[model samples]
Each structure stands twice: as structure tokens, then as C-alpha cells.
Target: MLSVDNLVASYNAGPVLQGVSLSVQAGEVVALLGRNGVGKSTLLRTLVGLVPSWNGSIRIDGTPLAPIATHDIARMGMALVPQGRGIIGKLSVADNLRAAMRAAGSRPALSIDQAIAPFPALREKLPAMAGTLSGGQQQQLAIARAMVGRPKVLLLDEPSEGVQPNIVQQIGQLVRKLADESGLAILIVEQNLELALATANRCIVMAKGRIVHSGPPDEFRNEAVLRRHLAL
Candidate 1:
């Protein structure tokens, strides 16, 4: 359960998220869809404390989160898989996962095997250098590392970036399955329409840093409706 009310944030002189409000219920996956620079990524960054919130509130299971450090937010049951998979090139995939558990700091967490279970391909690649892996593999590693912390809410920003279509489809299926089985609330900012509509239980559309429409995936599938927002 994650809640954000009247959330506002800025970058230097210009405002990005203008009084945004949204919520993602447990066991649900909500896809954030919008064109480039509509503040979809900014909202995710702000929720995780990477970007300072100029106003409003963010709560995890009713616990207020703001004026909090990024690492502290991760410890408080929130994990972020950023736009670009931020894996250390020199570190092995196993070490990357271990680092996440360490940050969890004695919190009930998932073992390396359990974390990599969703990604069977990753099981064998654990000993491989993260930098040498393919783009899709790197994305899987990023998400698996985040899951090692057993977060209550997962903020995934553009998981499909640089990944192949088939792999993107696989990830969408995995995300849907992960939400149902683990009851982890997920808010994903995705540019890929097919993946978002396929995986998400609900879809929220953004424009000019504000949420303009919220509906079921079918609503967003309409060509006319999609054109109004995305023009694809």
C-alpha cells in the first residue's frame, strides 16, 4: 500500500510534478504512461527520496516518508530499479544481490536463490560480470537485486529500456506474476504501450506533470484514446 497526496516537486526554477496524487494497492500493478518529460520518472524519483519533494506527502503503509535519505527509504521497504540498470560493471551478479541484502540490514529478506528464481536465466549468470551481460539480463539483475530486499513497494522506472521485445514481454509477465504471488505494490513508468497494458492491473496517464486520466488497461488500448495522449 503506497499513497501520495498533492505531491509537488521542482528542478531548480521549474516545477515538474504539479500537485500529483495517486495510490497503488497491495497486489496491484499500476503503469504510469506518458510521453517523454511529463514527469513520470520524476514522480518515481521523488517517492524514493532521490528528488526532494517541494510539498505534499508520501506514505508507505501509512508511514510518512519525506525529508528522508534515499538509502533510508530503501530500508523502509521501498526499492527502486532506476531507468538505467545501475549495476557495478566490475561486480559479479551475486555480489550485486548481496549488496542489496546488506542494505536491508537484518530485515526479513530473500536469499540470492529466491531473488533469482523469477529469473531462471540469471541463476547461472550469478558469477558473471554484470557489465558484460546483455541489456535484458542487466535489467533482470537490477530487478532481482531490488527484490532481495523484499520491498513492500517497488518503483520500476523503464524496465523495458534497451531490452528486446520478447524479453520485454517476459518481464511484463514476470511483473504481473510477482505482484500476484508476493502482493508487492508496483508503480512502473513505461514508454512501451504493449508491456504496460499487458502487465498492469490499472493504467494512469500523465501530461504536463499531472495525472490526466486513470482507467483500466482496456481503456488505454483504444486507438483514439491512445492517440489523444501518446499520438502513436
Candidate 2:
């Protein structure tokens, strides 16, 4: 499980995340929805230590996390699939996955085959350069790499971005399967409404760096409610 309490973060002289708070339980998928610049992505980055937290606490399974390095955070069972996929284009797909496992440092981990099982399309591309793959393939590779570490919490930023519709559905199915089978707690920042609804059990809406609404997916599906907070 992951708990973030009154998290405050800033960029330069301006604050980006103002007292944001949320939590995700094991075997649950939570979608974070909002318009652009609402600090959805910043909250993810802050939880993973990419952005410094100015105040409050982030705890993984009740352990404070702000004191550790990002790599250590990954080793402590947190994995992030960043907004852009963030794959190493020049490296072979196998190497990219290997890097994450290496950073995870011998925790009970998933084999390459197990990691790639959800993405059978990526199984054959293991020896190929990651940059040469299509956008969907690259995103699959990114998710696979994150899973190889056998993380307890998965932070996914815009998993649907730049992905084809079919591939987005594939990702959604894989995410739901992971939550159910792997007990992976997922916090996904997504703009695509349908993808969010399909992938997450619950939805949290944010505005101006603060969470404004939290409920089941059906409440989020109501057009008027969604439009009020997300302006979608």
C-alpha cells in the first residue's frame, strides 16, 4: 500500500503541488484525472523522488520514503513508468529490463518471460534496439521493464499517451490483471477518460495541485461531475 499525506512540492520559486494527499491499496488501481498543469504528474514524480518534496510525508507500507534516493526507492518496491515511456532508445530491450532488475538488486523478481507475458508482442523484440520499435511497442517495453523489478507500487504517468487505441486497451487489460493477480498498487495519471475508467477501480480528481474529488469510477463517469472538476 502507498500513502501520501499533505504533500507539498515546488519548482523554483513557484509551488506546483500544494498539499496533495491520496492513497492506493494493494490490489487496487487508482486513476488520477485532471486538466493539464493541475499537478497530477508532479504528484507522481514527487512520490518517486524525481521532484523534491517541500513538506509532508510519503510512506510505502508505512515506511517513510522521502529520505531515500530514487534508485533506493525502486529497490524498496516502487517502480515508475514515466509519462514519455522513458526507454533507452539505444539499448536492446533486454538490457533495458535488465537495468531495472539490477537496480532492484535481487529482490524476488520476475523473469524476462514472465515480465513480457502481458506483452507477447515484445517477446520477440528483446534483442532489437528499443528506438526502432513502434510507439506502442516502446510503451509496452517500458511497462515490462518496470514490472521486471517486481514492484509493490507502480506509478504510471500517461500510459495511454502516443499509444494506439488497441494497444491502449491491451495496456488497460494488463494493468487490471496486474492489480488482481500481482497485488500491485497502481496510481495512474491519465487524461484519456475511457482508458482511466476501464483501468481503475476508483478515480481521484485534482485541480490547482490539490485533490478535489475521490470516488468509484461510476461517479467519475457522470459527465457533469467530470466536467466540473476536470473540464473534460
TM-score of each: 0.97, 0.97
lDDT of 1: 0.91
Worst 10 residues of 1 by lDDT: 102-111
Model 2 C-alpha lDDT per residue in residues 1-232, reported as the tens digit of each score: 9999999998777889999889999999999988998898889888888899989899999999987888888888999999999999999998888877865656867788888888888888999999999999999999999998889999999999999999999899999999999999999998888999998999999989899899899888788997788776
Among these predictions, the greatest lDDT belongs to 1
lDDT over C-alpha atoms for residue 90 of model 2: 95
Each model's Cα RMSD: 1.1, 1.0
Mark the regions of model 1 whose C-alpha exceeds 4 Å error after superposition.
Answer: none
Weakest lDDT window of 10 consecutive positions for candidate 2: 100-109
| lDDT, model 2 | 0.90
Superposed Cα deviation of residue 55, candidate 1 (Å): 0.3
